[model samples]
Each structure stands twice: as C-alpha cells, then as structure tokens.
Target: MVEQLSLLAGEREVDDTAADIADPCEESGTSVSPMLPPAPLNGLSPSLERKRLQAYLALLVGDVAILLAAFYTVSILYFGTLSNWAMLEGGMISAYVILPLYLTVALYNGTYSRRSLTEWQTSAFRAATALVIAAALVNLLAFFAKSNAEFSRMVFALGLASTAVLMTAMRIAVSRALIRKWGPTSLNKMVLLAGGPKLNLPHALHVNASEHGLEPALDDPRALDRLSKYLRNMDEVIVSCRSEDRAAWAQVLKGSGIHGEVTHQLPHEIGAIGVVHYDAAGVSALKVSSGQLGIRARVAKRLFDATVSGLVLLIAAPLMLAVALLIKLEDGGPVFFVQKRVGRGNRFFAILKFRSMRESDDNGAQSTSLEDDRVTRIGRFIRRTSIDELPQLINVLKGDMSLVGPRPHALGSKAGSKLFWEVDRNYWQRHGLRPGITGLAQVRGHRGATDTETQLSNRLLADLEYMQRWSLWQDIAILAATLRVITHERAF
Candidate 1:
C-alpha cells in the first residue's frame, strides 16, 4: 500500500473524488496491500517551488530579450545602422552597463517574481520604477567615471524610454497569458486529502486510511512512512479525522514536510469552540500553529533587537559605569546579579541586572517586599527608578531575550499564594518567545510583583495577546510606551 502511494505522485494533475477515510487507529495493525498496483507515473511535472523558480527565470530571460530587442531596434531607427560596427560596440557597452543594474533593481523591486506574474499591475509599476532607477544609476556611474562623453546621449535616452515602455507591455501580456494558462494561481497545486469524510472537494485526491492500512500513530513508523510517501510532491495534505484522531494527524502533518491541515468537526460536535468555514480552503480546519513569526519577521526582529540594544548600551555606558560604582560602594558586593530565569522554549538562562538586593544565602527566586531590608540603600534607589533592569540590555544583546516580549520569570516565582504556572496553565505558553527587558504588560503597569491571581492573569493575558498580534511595529510601540511607565508606583 505504501509503494502504491508514491507511484501516484506523478499520475494525473489534481483529480479529486470522495474522501470517506476509514477506521479507528490501533498499534501494530495488519498490513493491507492495494487491490491493484498503481500505474507507473514516471512523467511527473516539477514541484510548485521549482515551477515558481523556473517561471521567475523565464521572466528574467524575457526581460533581457525585450531590453536587447528594444534597444538595438531603437538604435537602428535612430542611427540608421542595421549593421554598423559603431552601433554594435556601443550597444555591447551599454548592455554590459545597464543589464546588471536593471536586473538588480528589478529583482529587488519584485519585478521578476511570483507577485509580478500574479498581479500584473504591481509588476508594471515595479518594472517601470526599476528601469528608471537603473537608468539613473548607470548615468550616475558614468558621470563619476568621467565616461559619459563616450555614449550617444539621444540614442541612450530613446533606448531607455522605449525599453521601459516595452518591458511594461510585455509583462502585462505575459501575466494575462499566465492567468489563462494556470487559472488564478501561478501553479495549479496538487492536494491530497488523508482520511476525510465526504467533502464537496473534487479538486483533491482522497485516500481511505483503514483500507490502505494507514494510521496516525506516531510510534508506528511503518504507518508514518506510508503517509509520508502519499504526501510526497503534494502541495497540501489535509487530514480529516475524528476528534480523538485529530491530534495524531496533526503530529503526522508536522513531520510530513508539506503544508498540512486537520479538519474540524461541526459546531455541534466540538461545542463552544465555534466551527466556521475558511473560504480560502473551502473547509473548516483547526489551522494548527506552526510558528508565531515567519522568517522575514524573525530576521527583522533580530536586527531590531541587536541594533537597539547595541546603541542603548553605547549611549548608557557612562551611566551604567556610575551605577556599577554605586553598587560596589554600597556593600562591596558584586556589581551585577545573575538570576536563573525561564526563557524561550522553557530553557533556563542567567539574567543580568544591576545588583538591587543584599547578597544572601537564601534562594535567588525570592521576590523582594516593598520595605525588604535585603535591598541595600543604593539598591532601593536603583530599583525605584528601574535602573537595575538596564543590565538586561546585555541579555538582549546576547540573544537570550528580545527588546519586547514576555518578561522571564524565576522558577519559584509566585502569584499570590501559588506558583506562577500553578495560577494558570497557560503561563508556560508565554515562554514560546524569548523573554524581554520590558513588555506590553510592563508598559501597562503590570510589573514589579505578581501579588495576586488577577495581576498574574492580566500579565499572562497581555503576553499571549502580544504573541498573537506580534509585529516589529508593535514591539516599537511597546518600547515607546515603556518610557512613560519607567518610574511606576510599584517599581520598588
């Protein structure tokens, strides 16, 4: 049955029928063979990712052809040199100069990308902008090199103007032609549905789990291998299973190395957790969370954190040095205190802060009281102004924390009479992201101490909300808001 599945990867394009997947899972099930051997589907088209790359390359080549054709044709019309050696040399030099600049700008502006192929209007504008910028750059480079005199100014101007016009026209024509060829999307994705009830989806391939001896048991490597085989080259693999089976299928999808979804039951079956249709997939699904931040978002966030932290440290070095002197003079103790706190992925890290409390043999997780004698004279002043927290900028630089995220907590930290996590099971979920120096909760005056359940709940709620609606802009807003709440009433 598993061998039969891989054989179907190259079969037909997007043929969907029924999806009446079968049977509850059990460990060590009997192997079931396919009734008929799958056809040897050897003539498979390229994967969607490859197809997009190929399309982008083709568009790039087309742009080059168009530019050459337009420029040389314009040169012939302008200089009446269909075969002139002077025109040939000039064209070659111009091509060498303009082609690299134009292609670089076009790639940056998304002129030869999927968006260009999909939405021709944006592509047209982007293509025109790239050409204009490239032309300006070439002229600028020539000016600096003192070589502008060698080129024909009128012919150059005419060629650039004509090429820009031709490029835009060609892109529009190509995009429209693409739409007719591949419907709405650039690539008609082939989707395979695993173990679903009857669906009105005729554009997908359906499989019966039990009949094919497929199970969503993680421990069953054979079953997982079979499912993986079935999903090879599939753009999307949707698992429609009973409620008890959904979790297993979701795990399978995570390891399947393909975009996947698990179907949700009707509203009546799930209760309270409302079931609604997703127009994009034309089905109701749980849309399992793969990640909170995508690659671009993560990169932007890391850059922001590093840049801000580095600058802040540089600007605050003198102030920090003075604080360190005060800290050392206070009791002749360590200038910085390192506490074990839970960070991203529930891992423990040493958080750095200006020593704000007297050195003692007690557990470091103990929260200080308003008038705790353990806080030294200098510690009191620094804690009140939140200056003790400045050293955490080092943590941000070290990549153990972000500029704005849920603040990390000590392992023994408590809310009222109970441990922080004990107050709410979701307390651990906030650790999915790196901890921060200041966060939405801190900006909103939820800092200092978690003295009550409501206080902890509010912070947890804010952290979760921040995660759900996270963005670099939001982090910036949180940082801006932090300034106003730096010296809060509960700081000490």
Candidate 2:
C-alpha cells in the first residue's frame, strides 16, 4: 500500500496536479515493479548526535563558568582593591558570598541556555529583581542571625553590580561566540516542499519552518531524497505542507520510520507556534509556543518606554547637559551626534546620542573602542558612565526607538558588507521590532566595540528574545534595573 501510494505520489511539487499510477496487478501482460526509493532521514548520526550534544553542553557550561568567574574576579578586584570592607571583613567576603549568590541567581535564571533566559530587557529585569530579592532576603536573614554587621552593603551592592555586568557581558559573548561558531539556530534541518508564490523557496521555507519553530534542513525539494535519509537517521521529519500529494509524502515519511507532521497544523498541534527551535535532537524537542507581541503589548511597551525614558531623561538631563557642555568645550563640535541606524525591518532612522568622540567620520563605520583616540577626556568619563547615551531620549520620544530594545547598529555596519543578517541570513530575523537604547547587548556587556562576529551574534540573540517575548512590565523593570547599571557602569 505504501509503495502504491509512493508510485501515485511520485516526485512532484505538492501543489501541482496529482498523478495517477495504475495498479501493477491490473496491467495487461506485463509486470510492474515499484520505482520508489528507500526512505531516508535528514538528521545527524548517533555519533554526530552525541558529539553535538556534548559540544553544546561543553560550550554552555564552559563559557558560562568562565564568564561568571571573570565577573567574580573583576568585582572582587574593583571592590576589594580599595581599603574598604574587605580590610574590615578580613577576607574577600564580597567575592566569596556575593559571587556564589550571583552565580546561583544566574543559573536559576537559565542564563546558560543556547537561547537566552529572556529578552534583554526581560532578562535584565529578572536579573535585577532576582538580585534585589536575593539581597533583601539575605540581609534579612543576616539581621535575624545577628550577622548583618559582618557585611557591608557597599561591598554587597558592588558584588551584585559586578555580577550583573560581567554575567551579562559573558552571556552576550558566549551567545555571539556560539552563533558564530555554530551558526544561527534558524538555519537548521527543515525541508521545503513548496509550490508557488504562496510558498516560495527562501521565504516560504523561512516562514513555514519559522512558524513551526523548526529550521528546515534544506530548502530544495531536489534534495528531498538526501533529506529523507537525514530525517530517518534523526528519527524526525517535518513535511511542512498540506499538498494534493500529501498522502504520498506521508507514505514515504512513514516508510522512512520517522515521526513527521505538516507545517500548517504545527501552531495548534505542536504548541510551537512562533518560538524558534534550533538543533533539536528529537520530535519532542521540536516543541515551541507562539510568542506574539500583539497590539495591546506594543501599546503597553511604548507607553512603558515613554514613561521610563521620560522620567530617566528628566533625572539624568542635568548630568547629560553637563556632559554635552563638556563635549562642546573639549572639541567645540556638536553636542548631540546623530547617525543613521538600522532598526526593525531594516528601516533606517536617526539615532541621537551625546557625542562621545571628536566629530569626525575618520574610521568610516567602525565601532569605537576604549583606546580610540577620537574619544575626548570628558567623553571617556561620560561613556564609561553611559551618560553619553542620554540624548537617545529624543529617539524614544520620536518613536524611532524604545527605552529597551536591541541596540541599533550603524547604517554601514556589516559582517564583511553583508550586514549581520546577510552574514547569517538569520540576522534580520531579529529586526522585527524597534531598536532600543540599552538592550540585551548593552546591559549584558555587549555595549562596547563589536570587533568580531561572535559579539554581534550574541547581541542578535538578546534582541530576538526581546521581540519574541516582551511585555510592559518587563519594560518598566528593565528601565529600573538599567538605572542601577548606568549608575555603577556595570554594563560599560
């Protein structure tokens, strides 16, 4: 029956007219043999499976631990180097106690996931909330235990701030590094069985698989034979369309002994509506829930951004003005530097910021670095304090940006002239919404020079996470936490 179905369904586009294969037994004076090939899967081998999992876990744990450790070391050195609480406590208590606590918090927050714990703002909010709650709880416990006097709030705050900065940075770094090393999860294991305009190759495959949270292995139906082998080996296959020849495809898939499904039913049947799935090991892991940020959510997010950015601009305006005055005095150039930036959907818009360097297009579109000579003395201080970013409130006001979204990249920014998206093709996928002032990238220490592909990739992950799952409450919370980070220069 399966062979009969395959013969009937012979290799043809799903939407094309269905072909009829006469039954072999009914043929006159002739015997017909089924021409169907053996079903093949488009998946990794067992050895490859084990290796991939091992590699993923190694990257996850090794990088996470390294980042946490670096954060711990930096915090201890910065806070303990001065003759403050460390001298009084007689040990590196800030490093010991607070470091462990922050690590615990990060772990609980799932910072180690290939996908980030949450969107940048959401993660920042969660991390900040966790730190605050943890601090309060610990302090209360210390008070009850009569040990509050043993610890200094300054040192404790320092530890938390350091952890936030370093943890965020490392998360950014690791994500970027992994993305560069392993490529975006969006470009994996989906097979495109498309027909026409309603389902073109590149986009339809992108959308259908993206909708199912499944990355198509390859888009060409000509490679379907090879893909079948891969899927059979992987034990999972996604047909990705309901065609006139759906039954034929089903037979081949069934014969291949792989679990499979149509893409249209994915949203409801699999519950993985919009959440993107990458490098999944099994059909069970293909699970994803739609993460839609609708009108109500957008309205709420915008209101939250305006309120928070407005309040923050009000409070920080004096300092921002001071920095602007200093920039003018130092270089006698424009106080606010406006540049074209790529926002949601590759839209070009002006991003406003307190100029941190001498007004010159000297380096073309390169990112500024710590040692960049163009940075003025006052610019250095303001940049470190993140005060230079204050003028972006105007951007928030103009609705060109959010108080918290993925940081915008300069117009000519590129991964070798391809733009980050063109380099990975999945880069533009993150641009589904507005960019922000302090994003997952900034808060997590990806704020400085993006000299490498890994850094941009990590930043992209954070931005995508934010767009995929965002709320007004999350925005408000990010705003508050961002205040602490800016005040302490945790995010650089």
Name the lDDT value of residue 93 in candidate 2. 50
| True-structure lDDT of candidate 1 | 0.68
Q: After superposition, how far is residue 142 of candidate 1 from its true place, in Å?
A: 23
Clashes of each: 0, 21
Residue range 454-485, candidate 1, lDDT tens digits: 99999999998998899999999999999898
Position 489, candidate 2: lDDT:
32
Measured against the true structure, the TM-scores of the candidates, in listed sequence, are: 0.51, 0.41
Q: Which stretches of candidate 2 lie over 4 Å from their true place?
A: 1-292, 362-364, 414-419, 487-492
In the order shown, what is each candidate's alpha-carbon RMSD?
12.9, 22.7
lDDT of 2 at 461: 74
Whole-structure CA lDDT of model 2 = 0.51
State candidate 1's TM-score. 0.51
- Indicate which candidate wins on TM-score: 1
Alpha-carbon local distance difference test for all models: 0.68, 0.51
Winner by lDDT? 1
Query: Residue-wise lDDT of candidate 2 within 1-492, one digit each (tens)?
Result: 000111112332221111242321222223323443222222222212333444435544653464346444554565555456436453345345544565576556644332442233444555555566666667777779897777756656655676567545654565565445434431233343432113222211222322212222222122232333334223234454444544444433432323344434333346664432332322112221121343345557778878877887889777877777788888688888777565543344667777777755522366665577877788778777777787888889888788888787764465544455444535544545677887665566665656668877777777767665677666666666776678443322
